[model samples]
Every structure is written in structure tokens, then in C-alpha cells.
Target: MEGNHSAHGAFILLGFSDRPHLERILFVVLLTLVGNTTIILVSRLDPHLHTPMYFFLTHLSFLDLSFTTSSIPQLLYNLAGHDKTISYAGCAVQLCLSLGLGGVECLLLAVMAYDRFVAVCKPLHYMVIMHPQLCLGLVSLAWGCGVANSLIMSPMTLWLPRCGHRKVDHFLCEMPALIRLACVNTAVVEGIAFILAVGIVLSPLAFILVSYGYIVRAVLSIQSSSGRHKVFNTCGSHLTVVSLFYGNIIYMYMQPGASASQDQGKLLTLFYNIVTPLLNPLIYTLRNKEVKGALRRLIWGNLHLRKTI
Candidate 1:
């Protein structure tokens, strides 16, 4: 392991090196990047999507894009060739960005849930309640919280002395994997991390569930079945995304152990890092009628202009 650490402070990423085939399949991360970019562009270009929901969605897409880009490109580069080493600075940036973006997503999802709750329970006041100023403030708060989490956690994790043990068992420089590298006792760090996890992960999730509970009651009170279905359709995509994002995150972070199994840890990380981002755009676009219409208009509008020329 001494050879894995360089004099200039580099860490060897031992990500799926033993399984070359799996590395090849992980290239799907490219699609994750593209999909997130499309969501950002479409949401901005379509005037019909100028509501608070799409506003939050645009931020979510940006976070996903930044989050995946921070790690996946390096992973792919390592997988593509023999060089599996990441500079100490590079690893630190990846860890910080991923942590910050992930934290933001958790809080943002809760914000979106609240937006849904207002839209459903108090339709007449939805616009007044979720005004532009409030939306911006909420998003800013989420970003601030995420940045604070990363500042608190990333530095502590990175400060641990590896003592020449620099080979990370997983693909990216995650908190749990980095913690495992410390030569000294990490019980204190682990405890702090667990506490933060509860605050950052579980708290938002509970909020989402509670918001949905109110939403459910409101839907039940609607006399028309079509109204109920419409409300469900509007929110189902968000629910699906919340389940996918939080389920994997809770299992990965909320466990007593940082990661029970290194192999399992890699797969779960890959799922959220790659698969979830890829699916988010698909889930929203396919399930959302407004987005689909906007996309069609954008496409045919361009086509018609070209034909006229």
C-alpha cells in the first residue's frame, strides 16, 4: 500500500479494478450528465415551466449535473486506462462538491414537497405562498446548509492521517471510505457524522412524508375523481424521485456502520450518483404533460424555422 501513495500526495482509487467488465458498464454515467443538462435547458427555455416547481427542478438538475461531473469523469478516466491515482487536491474537491450537492438535494427535495403541499392543499394561494422571493430564499437556504455540511465534514475527514495507506476501496472519495483510511481512532468523527446524517438526511425525509400526508388528506377531500387523479399525477414523479434518492441515501448513510460491505457500498454509490440522476429527468419528463408539450414545441418550433429558411 505504500507504493499507492505518492510523495506529492496522491491516492490510488481501487474502484472496480478487479472487475473490468463492471467498469465498462459504468460508462452510463455519461448519460446521467447529458440527461441532467437537458432538464436544465428545457426548464429554462419553456415559459410554461416557469412555476415554482420547475424552478426547484432546475436547481435540482444543476445539482445532479455538478454532483455527477465532480466524480464520474475521474472514475471513467481511471477505468479507461491504467492510471487510477487522484491528486490529493482532486480527491478533496470531489469529496466536498459531492457532499455539498448531495446535502442540497436532500433539503431541496423537502422544499419541493412543501411546494406540492401548498399547491394541492391551498391551490388558490399557491402562487401567493410560494412567491418568487420565497422560492429564491428557500433555494438559497438549501445551498447554504449544504455548503455548511461539506465544510464541517470534508475537512475533518480529509485531515485524518492515512499513514501511507492511500488506496481508497471505493470509486470516489466518500466520507465513509475516507474515514476508513485514518490511521488513528475515528470514533469521534463517526459519531459526529451520524448526528449530522440524522439532521441532514432523516429530517428532510420526515418533512417530505408529513407534507405528503397533508397532501393525501387534501386529495381525499376533493369531490371529483379527476381532480384527485390530476393531483396524484402532478406529484407522483416527485414521490418516485424522493423514494429513489432517499431510500439509497438512508441505507448508505444511516446505517450504524459507514458501509457494511465495500462492494455493496460501491454499487449503492453508483446508483445514486449515476442511475438516480439519469432517471430524474426521465421521470419528470415522461410523467409531466407540461414538460412533454414544451419539449415537442421546442423541437417542432426549431424544425419549422429550419424549413422556412
Candidate 2:
């Protein structure tokens, strides 16, 4: 069945358009975008930091970069202007990309946890176990699964009988908000969404928990306090990231948007999309000595080269 809405149909993203203060949200989005970009560059430029862990972090940075970029700019535009309309095609694209990147991040976080697990549980074998080919394969698999999920979910959600109800009650074209606009009974679609949410969110979360369970066991076996501390620092940033990402996600999708008011949901989505990406670099660079050292060397090395010039 063809969508009654034309391709040119527009959605009014009620994104902070209701709020008197919009500058702060714009500032936060731009700042976080820059921070995520910097993490990607720093991870790439520092040769000493080129390990499986940092490799995953680089992938993560890139995911956050693309993920936030997919929606935040449009969101900022809506926040800044009285004209908050998003073209139907634009909304579709936003939904697809955001969902894909978000799924990738969720799965990739679990993969990172496994990377930490192997590093801590099998130190001597870490290099051999997490080889270049395996790392590439894992990252590729993550991207593939993410894209596949978006392919499935986005089209179905967009094709829903919206009956021209086009005002999306959030800053972005998120799945839940779009779903809420459907005019027809959306039980099956919502059910599928719930299942996909479980697969994308909970499964990865469970894997992370299991990986950390093994990690904790291994850390407990270490007699040296310094050894334990070193291991803890390595995993802490990732653990924090997982907690933030999954916690909001699980709550948001727990029962088909029953958990929060539209306003509250927007704030939660804001945290996940904006605040989390901003904090990711800060968390890793601050808590992990290796990233900090690499960043410092990169900064000083640039300065020294400039002096020569």
C-alpha cells in the first residue's frame, strides 16, 4: 500500500521549539560533535595507542560522530527556527541512519567488552587472540548488523498509516515518536520493534555483563593491587559507557513509550544522543592512562614541530 502522505510531506519536529531557551542545546550538540571528532582524530594520529582496544575506541568515536550528526543538526535547526518542518524523505533517512548507528554502537560496546575480557583474562594471548583480521571481522560484523536492523525497522515504521499526523514530538525522528504518530493499530509493528529493541539493546547488554563477570573473576585472582588497578582502569571507561547507553535505551523502549512523558522522553533522548557522546571521550581519556599519555604526546609533538617550522 502506498503511503497517503506525499514524499514532500513535512514533519514538524517539536524539538525544543516549545522551550524559550534553545541556545544551550545547540551549544551542547556542537560541542559534543567536536569532542567526538577529536577523539576519532586522536585515536588515529597516535601510533603508540594503536592497539585492539583503541582501535575499537576509534570505531566507537566514528559511530558516535555519525550517529549524532545524523539527527542533531536538524534538531538544532528546529530548535533555532520557527520553521521546524522536516521533509518526509529527510525524516526517513534520519530514522534509518540514527537507528543503524545506534544499533552498531550497542553491539560494538559488547565487542569492546569482550576485547577487555580477553586482555584481562588472557594477557599473554591478547595479541594473538584479538588479531588484525579478527578485529576487522568483528567491526565489520557490527556495522553489517546495524545496517541490517535499520533496513528492517525504518521502512516498516515509515510505511505506517500516519494519516497525515506528522508532528514528531521529539527533537529527532526517533522510532518511538514516529511510531506514536501512526494512525492504524500498531501492535504488530510495535511488537517487532520491541523484539528488535531486545535484540539490539538487551542482548548486547547481557553480553557486556557476562564479559565483565569473567573480567571480575580474573581481577580477583590477581594478587598485586597495582595489577588489579591497572586492569580496572582499562575496563572502567567502557563499563561506564555501556551503563549510560543501555540504561536510557532499556528505559525508553521498555513498553512502547509508556515510561516517560513526551517532554521527558525528549530529555532522555537528548542525554543519549548528546550527553553520552560528549562524555565518552572524557571518560576514556581521563580514566585511562594510555589514552591520556597518547593525547599529551600528540599535543606536545605538534607544538615541537611548530617550533621547528
Strongest candidate by lDDT: 1
TM-score of each: 0.95, 0.95
Question: How high is the lDDT of residue 206 in model 2?
Answer: 90
**Pairs that collide, model 1:** none
Instruction: Give lDDT tens digits, candidate 1, residues 158-215.
Output: 8877778889998998888888877778888888878988999999999999999999
Candidate 2 residues 195-265, lDDT tens each? 99889888998999999999999999999999999988888888999888888878777655434578777
Q: Against the hidden true structure, what lDDT does model 1 obtain?
A: 0.88
Which residue segments of model 1 deviate by more than 4 Å? 1-8, 256-259
lDDT for position 121 in model 2:
93
Candidate 2 versus truth, CA RMSD in Å, comes to 1.8
lDDT of each structure?
Answer: 0.88, 0.84
